[model samples]
Target: MTDPTPGRALPLEGVLVVACEQAVAAPLATRHLADLGARVIKVERTGRGDFARDYDTVVHGLSSHFVWLNRSKESVSADLKDPDQLARVRDLIAGADVFVQNFAPGAAERLGLGADDLRRDHPGLIHCSISGYGSTGPYRDAKAYDLLIQAEAGLVSVTGTEDHPAKAGIPAADIGAGMYAFSGILAALYDRERTGEGTTFEVSLFDALSEWMGFPLQYAAGSGHAPVRAGTSHPAIAPYGAFAAGDGVEVVFGIQNEREWERFCEVVLDDPGVATDERFASGSARVENRPALHGAIDAVLAGLTGDELVERLERAGVANARRRTLDEVLTHPQHEQRGRFVEVDSSAGPVRTLLPPITFDDGRTPRMGPIPDVGPGV
Candidate 1:
């Protein structure tokens, strides 16, 4: 691995990560590591590499999913079924500071790349295994795609409208597992520094998403009922969610407290007495009579343009935002003002991408390396 320039080193500058990854979860984890300056060597199949590379051709003939997840990483093509290729991968892992894999259940062991076997030989290696259900459990070998995991973890049950439950627009389960794996690997690295020994860990999409469903799960457990699936609206809050103006522009806002609620009625609704109405007096009362409350708000808002509604909300100190489309979000003023967007070289060409969410106080930027084409085995 090349050394980072002096006095501008990233957090994981010297770390070497060898990842046998595909699809979203493992790629995302390694990509984050690569962003922080880890030397990530991604192992892929000899021919097509990652299947996600064929998910779509929206980004200059490259898959949007692949481009979004894989940056600042090196790719190596290998047929793991071949003994020589498998041996080379094992050798690479033997020298790596961290080894990450998301192989199907028992696949790693079959290839002699299992955490137990590798860690036995290299105690200083951080071994992380990301899977669908986990190494154990009845669902261990079950096919665990993003939607499947979302359904199994009850995310779909709580998402979308009451009439039609929906998976999240994004791959929530895959992202959750990827982030957890990334963090778990970071923690293990730190632990190694303190104890002089590396660690073994596992992160499953099911567990990650189940942890994410903590609030709804606890709510159901304590209240003896699941929260209602209100599309883009809160089940327990009234006057929350999207509202259309006279010009048909959508605005989303939420009233978090009685003060805000009162202000919303007086300034935005232009009716102070509405705040004291029996159906809307208390939070619970408003939620209980949400339909009537929405009707009241809609009646007042129907006459106002989107700009007028936004102005009133601002005057009332009500937290609000436009229900922006994906294209609008790409040109959002916040991102533009913050200089979040950047260009990176890819196999297709220079592609536009947002900087990683993390910002260093010292002004050291994360690595923005090229997206590699699948190359011969390392």
Candidate 2:
């Protein structure tokens, strides 16, 4: 939709945000708002700025994660511990439509940036706090990281092979908290328009990840046991995983229901009778005999190349995909077909990034601006 405000202003053009944030979750959330046209002013500690900027020197001598999350933001250095800095923040917060802070519980409050204190001064300012844990409860003060949250939330327990659990390759918990914080800010912004009153929003890494664990939690509670850690395999379905092809490539495939099972047995496995075999007759039964069923399908796939097997599976109305590495995915045909890539500028120079997944009727693409530097720009 064309922004009703005109002049091609982004969705949040006139909004002013002040973020007292560091690290991944909060910065990522505020950065996205900046991308959508908010004037984001990131408040950082004087001298070194966000510590995440020095977490690594991998992306053209910059922290890869920092550059990716802190783009399109202006930086202002202020020591929250100092009276002058605190006063300056109050001044900034007074004018801000939204104020974000990801400091630990009590930290923002100690510095007088707590949502309650700030809201009293600026009744219409939306205050958001992103923390490792919420303000209350026993574990609220516990140090939490993405991997730690994943483990605490039981994601690790079901992710890897049966013998050993592994953390997800990406920072799922951090990303989840960030996304929630971003959406929470948006909701608060909308509410302010109607009520003429601002609200406080809080997102914790542990809480965000815990909500995501509901499926496995319910399954374990109902089943009277934990879900099996079937690496690259589904817990509730059979013959749903990757298999080796004759050309030494791997292809992942899935079967959702009885219809797909029938199609697989008849076309892919070339054995219609296998569909009605007592041990593999139903979804639950197939899951019980997954080993035998997988072996049967593997034997057939062993004779066909990965490309040929995928083509045949698609023609038979089965879902199948080839597993590609990050490098391979960069130049994948689907990216060009879907126009998913766009060029973005950074201190390191220009880089290509995947565009936002959403498409518009007017086809006006969002901007891919530069990642800013420390000291002066976030």
Candidate 3:
């Protein structure tokens, strides 16, 4: 019998993608494609498959990262080094609208599946190449992981507490590169419909993250100095970031302009005179006296429980939030109210997850189906 509630399909139906890939960058790009209704065939090495499969066994014996990124893909094992297998891979591309890969530099060319090689014949194909650095650069061949790129991109230097610089908890560089690849492929597909000519696209983690560094780059350019690492705190803004509340729950808030500062003094802190204090009069002044200002705000906030204080901040028009643990976030009321949970099949079993951030007019949310094993019929 059918369940009481039927499942919704993702948005990319009818599109076919042959992803000759591995790791987070490629799989993340293809997973989104699958989410949007594309038929994504993940081509893995014949024996071992994506190395990520062995990244962990936390999720009932599957890598949580792989599970998160590889859902809904159809696993297809084919050795690119094997001539017959490579021919089969090409056959897949011949029938597919898009081909994606993050193979090492010159690796794709050796296999005769490089973007240039594919474009010569499959003029209508949208070929996307994802890489660590880029096709051509001094660091083109330099190895890149999320942490390494963070340092190379100068992200790590400006992240974390002043005592220690740390990498991002997530693979932001990889995700950024994958997103660019996905969009490039989409734009290429759109272009082929008009010009009937295939286009090759390339995304480098360095460039991808460089775009993300725009703000800090501009900041440094204008100030003639890079921002100092502040951990979870906003580098420029004062009285922002986390602070402990009375109930032992931490709440976060920031003071912006004189208006907000005055309001903060009059309302939440209930010390109207503090706004006129020379130290707290302006944003820069407050930043200059951050330790004292933060101490004052912390003292006031610590007198109230997490919820009560959040209410106070909300009433005063200050942005505030309850620090939520991962477990708490999974059942957050806003997501539940918006009906974001979705069920998808997996090799291990069925699993549920949240929908993408984007919403559409058709009242349909993108679906993440099942997680596929590294090898077919495994």
Q: If both were scored by TM-score, which would come out higher, candidate 1 or candidate 2? A: 1
Question: Which consecutive 10 residues in model 3 have the weakest lDDT in total?
Answer: 1-10
All candidates: TM-score: 0.98, 0.95, 0.94
How far is 111's C-alpha from truth in model 3 (Å)?
0.4
Q: What is the lDDT of residue 17 in candidate 2?
A: 96
Residue range with the least summed lDDT across 10 consecutive positions in model 2 = 1-10
1-378 per-residue lDDT for model 2 (tens digits): 113234456678899999989989999889878767788888888888899989999877888788778767888888777787689778988899999998889988888888788989889989998888788999899999898899888999989988989999989899999999999999999998999999987999988988989999999999999899998899998888878898988998889999998998888878899999998999999899888888778888899998889888987899888888888898999998987887666778776677665455564555456766765522
lDDT of 3 by residue, 79-150 (tens): 676788889889889888899999998899999998778878887888888999989989989998888998
- TM-score, cand. 3 vs. native: 0.94
Which residue runs does candidate 3 get wrong by more than 4 Å?
1-11
**Residue pairs of candidate 2 with colliding backbone atoms:** none
Task: Write one digit per residue (lDDT tens) for candidate 1, span 197-286.
Answer: 989999999999999999999999999999999998898888889999988999999999999999999999999999999989999999
lDDT of each: 0.93, 0.85, 0.82
Point out the higher-scoring one by TM-score: 1 or 3. 1
**Top-scoring candidate (lDDT):** 1
